[model samples]
Target: MGWLRAAVLGANDGIVSTASLVLGVAAAHGSAQSVLIAGIAGLVAGSMSMAAGEYVSVHSQADSERAELERERHELQTDVEAEHKELAAIYASRGLDPVLARQVADQLMAHDALDAHARDELGITEAFRARPLQAAAASALSFAVGSALPLLMVALTPASMLLPLVFATSLVFLAVLGALAAWAGGAPMGVGTLRITFWGALAMAITAGVGMLFGVSG
Candidate 1:
C-alpha cells in the first residue's frame, strides 16, 4: 500500500502525456507512422524519467532518515542520561505522568533504545521506511502500463480518425484508472474520475492546439 500512491501518480502522468502527444501529432495531420513514433518515444522517455525521479526522491528520504538516526546514535552514546531524560520528556508531553513516563522510557531503552526513539520520538517506523528500488520499479512499471494503452489505441485505429479516437479512448482510460485508484484508496470514485478526465482533456486540447498552430505555420 505504501507504493500505491506513487504508482497511481506515475500511471496517470504516463496516460496523460503519451495520449496528449499522440493526439497532438494527429491533430497536426501527422502520418500514423509519425504518431506512433511520438507515442512510443514519449512512453519510453516518460517511464525512464518516472523511474529516475522516484529513485532520487525516495533515496533522498532514506538518506535523511539515516542521517537523523546517526545523530541520535551519537547523542545516545555521548550523553546516555540526557537521551533517557529526553525520551521520558517526550512520553510525558504525550500524556503520561512524569514518573510513569520515566519508567516506561527506561524499559523501552533497556529493550531497544534506538528503535524506540526512532519510532516514538523521530516518527520513523519500519512500515514507512523508504525503499528506493521498490519505488523506482513501481513507478516505471506503472508508467509503462499506462502509456501502453494510448499507444495501443494508435496502433489499432485508422489514421483519419486517430485524433478523436485517441482523445475519446484516453479520456475513458484515465477516468477508469482514476476511479479504480480512488476506490482502492477508499476515496470518492466519481470525483476522482471527473478530476482526472478534466485534466487529461485539458492537456490533450492544449497540446493539440499548439501542434495545429505550429503545423500550419511550419
Candidate 2:
C-alpha cells in the first residue's frame, strides 16, 4: 500500500511536469519540433534534479543521524548510570510507573543499551534510517517514468491538437494516479482524483499563461 502511494506520486510528478512543459510551449505558438524538444529537455533535467536533490537531502539526514548516534554512544560510555536514569525517565513519561520504568530501563540497558537509546531517546530506528544512494536512484527513476508519458503523447498526436490533447490526457493521468494513491492510503478515491486533477490543471494553466505572456512580449 505504501509502495502504491509512492508510485502514484512519482508518476504524477512526471506526467504533470512534462505535460505542463509541452503545453506551455504549444500555447505560446512554438513549433511541434520545439515543443517536443522542450518536453524531452524537461524530463531529463527534472529527473537529474530529483536524483541530486534527494541524494543531498538524504545524505544530510544520514550524517545528522550518525552524528547523534556518536554523541549518544559517548554519553553511554562515559556515564552508564546517568544514561540509565535518562532512559527510565523517558519510560516513566510514557505512562510507566517510576519503579517499573527503572527496572525496565535497567533490563533494556543490560541487554542492549545503545540500541535502546538510539530507538527511544534519539528516535532513530534501524528500519527508518536514510539511504542516500537508494533514495536518489528511486527518485530519478520515478520522475523519468512519469515524464515520459507526455513525450509519448507528443510523438503520437498531431500538432494541431497537441495542446488540448496534452492538457486533457494529463488530467486523466492525474485522476488515475490520484485514485490509486487514495485507494492505497484507504481514502476516498473521488476526493483524491479531484484533488490531484485540480492542482494539476492549475499548474498547467499557470505555466501556459506565463509562456503566453512572455511569448507575445518576446
Candidate 3:
C-alpha cells in the first residue's frame, strides 16, 4: 500500500510535469525537435529527482525504525523481568485479565521476546519497515514510464497539430493514470481520474496562454 502510493505519485508527477513543459514550449513557437528535447530532459531530471528524494526520505524512516527497535531490544536485554511485566500490562490494558495477560506474555516472550514486545507492545515490525532502495527504484521506473507517453506524442505528431494533439492525448493519459492510481490505493476511481485530468488541463491551458501572450508581445 505504501509503495503503491509512492509509485502512483511518481508517475503522475512525471506525466503532468513533462506534458505541461512540452505544451508550454510548443506554444512559444518552439519547433518539434526543441519541444521533444525539453520534454526528454524534464523527464530524465524529474525521474532522477523523485528517486533520490524517495530514497533519502525512506532511508530516514528506516533509520528511525531501526533505532527504535534497537532501543526496545536493549531494554528487553537489560531488564528482562521488567519487560515481561510491561508486556503483560500492555495486554491487560487491552482488556485481558491480569492472570491471562501474564500467561500470554510469558508464552510469547518464551518464543521470541523482542518480536513479542515489538509487535504487540510497541506496534513495530519488520514487515512495515521502509525500504529505501525499493522506493527509489519504483519512483525512477514509474516516472520514466509515465514521462515517455508525452515525449512520444511530441516526437511523432505533425508540427501543425502538435499542441492540440499533445493536449488531448496527455489528458487521456492523465485520466488513465489517475484511475490506475486510485484503484491501487483503493480510492474512488471516478473522482481520482477527474481530479487529475482537471488539474492537468488547467495547468496546460494557463501555460499555453502565457506562452502565446509572450510570443505575441515579443
List, residue by residue over 1-218, the lDDT tens digit for candidate 1.
54787799889998999999988888888889999999999999999999999999999999999999999999989999999999999999999999999999999999999998899889999989988998898999999999999999999998888888889999999999999998998999999999999999999999999989978987
Best by TM-score: 1
Span of 10 residues, lowest total lDDT, candidate 3: 1-10
**Distance from true position, residue 73, model 1, in Å?**
0.8
Please identify model 1 stretches exceeding 4 Å from their true place. none
Q: How high is the CA lDDT of each candidate model?
A: 0.92, 0.87, 0.89
> Any runs in candidate 3 off by more than 4 Å, and if so which?
93-98
lDDT of 1 at 14: 89
Q: Tell me which residue pairs clash in candidate 3.
A: none
- Local error of candidate 2 at 126, Å? 1.5
TM-score of each: 0.93, 0.88, 0.90
Can you rank all candidates by TM-score, best first? Answer: 1, 3, 2
lDDT of 3 by residue, 1-218 (tens): 44766788888888888888998888889888888999999999999999999999999988887888899999988999999999999999999999999999999999999899889877776777688998898988888888999899998899999889999999999999989878877889999999999998999899888878777777
